[model samples]
Target: MAPRAGGLYVGKMVRFTSVGLRYAPPAGSSDPGMGQDVLSDLSFELPAGSFHWLLGPSGAGKSSLLKLMQLAQRPSRGEMEVLGVITSRARRGELPALRRRIGVVFQDFRLLPHLSAFDNIALPLRIAGRAELALRADVTEMLRWVGLEPKAESLPPELSGGEQQRIAIARAVVMRPALLLADEPTGNLDAVQSRRVLSLLQEMHRMGTTVVVATHSESLVNAYPGPALRLADGRLER
Candidate 1:
């Protein structure tokens, strides 16, 4: 079915005008008062359902850009509209709702070691107060898609690094969020494993999920076919 004009189109193309971001330094750093200026005057619009890859060297602020999109942190300057909502001025009380619409995958694969694969995948739905019965079906389906059905009862420690990362991906998309941000998702995997992971991400994108993958891996960039946003010195060049 065609997406309606006014209603939400998950993973649909969205536009962003000028966007900028900065971060306050931690309590004590070399330059105590010098906060980090990550993204500067970033202006770009990511269409809904578009698959975008963020390429940059370390500390280039690619993750920071994704954080802004996820609404986990507000931009210090300019404005951003993701999933059709203005983000710079978004209220704190409104964050939970906005956050629930995003799915994030960290470079470290931040899965709860204590939770089973099933439980981990269901965490988002559970946090959003979805009914238990409904969560089970969705989580199960997501796990199956990621080829983790057999590991559904396993914990993070019991799985290989690749396996763990897939589980993290499963959890991220189990809720079918409109936006998916993956930070160095293939950083720890081998060539074959990375391809597997990227393939899964591609499948999600084809399913109408907006995907943004941030990575410094050139091999990954070559392997995955998609639009790219390159970051350098805290600015998006493309």
Candidate 2:
């Protein structure tokens, strides 16, 4: 079933109007191809507390769009609003706070190899200056939610791909972000693992976190259909 929004808000969480992105050349360089558009004239909105699929084939500029949404790259042209902050118009100093309200899961399962599962999940809270005792409780609850409480002291290398991904997901949401993004989250998992990961994501959406998932698997989409933003050649075709 397609995940439904929890009515957490009455408006959009993301808005892109005529957005374009071009990788700029290095200083003092004038190569003709240096500034070509990677994404052009894109417009879309992700409603607050809703779930969305970012659908497209490779080289379709999906990653570029994700980058823009994550505040990792500002659009070269047009307005881009994420979590209510229009990057082009916002001050440079305001981004970090906004970033904290967002969470991301990567396909590669970027958990720190040396850190214990508990420590990896606890890292973000530690960085945020969360009290050690309070964060311990939070991390414990996350491990329980992912059914990994027994594996807490294990390192990433000692766990299965699905477990590692779960740890990554746990880490991503440790702060309980308002917006959550997953880029090919099930790309590295088997059918069972993939379904488990998808379930966790859907649960997050149900809890009122605005979620966007970018993936190439049609079967996965068919399995859990949702509203989507389709892209082709860097444009929002739907």
Candidate 3:
């Protein structure tokens, strides 16, 4: 179901206006060009401090949509506006500054294999030049929130799939970006673990981060019971 618009509030803090995208096959490929389009004139509005789900079958272009939001890929056509800032003609330097206000968790759990979980979570803080004392406190609190405090010093290789997923989440949210994108965050987790992970996300939303999570799990969708932007054949199905 689409989220009801009017009652939420006027002058909402986030919006996505008429976004579009496409992807080509990688080099050295024998596959014929089929004019495949990954996204088509997608438009959605996300209010600040809200949670939205992007749900669809595999290969429905959920991840592609997210990359567009993150400005990792330019749109084939149309516009995406973030916090009233239009993206179409944005400079390369402008992107990084904009991205600092966003958080992302990919399906593969992109944690550094050589770094311990604590260091991984602190990466964003360190990059932003946060002080050592503040970094330590924030990173430690994030690990504890994700129930990974005991394994804070463990490298990614030493953790199970669920633990690694938690670490990825902790890293993504450490800086508390304005927008949070989680792609199939609980895909590898069991029911109990999935709930725990979802709860962590919910806690973030309560603290006013606009969140969008893409998942195919029906049970998880129902459990959270939020509006979903359903994608089909690489386009949003209204």
User: Can you give the TM-score per candidate against the true fold?
Assistant: 0.91, 0.92, 0.90
Tens digits of per-residue lDDT, candidate 3, 92-197, equal 7888867776789887898999999999999999888899997999999999989899998999999998899889989989987877899999988888878888
- Candidate 1 lDDT tens digits, 128-221: 9999988888988988888889999999999998999999998888777878889999898887778888998888899878889999988777
Query: Given candidate 3, what's the lDDT at residue 211?
Result: 86
lDDT of each: 0.82, 0.89, 0.82
**TM-score computed on alpha carbons, candidate 3:** 0.90
lDDT, model 2, position 123: 89
Query: What C-alpha RMSD separates each model from the true structure?
Result: 2.7, 3.9, 4.5
Candidate 2: residue 202 Cα off by (Å): 0.2
Candidate 2, residues 1-238, lDDT tens digits: the string is 1222442344678888999999998899978877889899998888888999999998888888888888888899999988767776899899887777788899998899989999999988988889999999999999999999999999999999999999999998989887899989999999999999999999999998999999989999999999998888888885
Residue 134 C-alpha lDDT in model 1: 80
Candidate 1 local lDDT, residue 196: 88
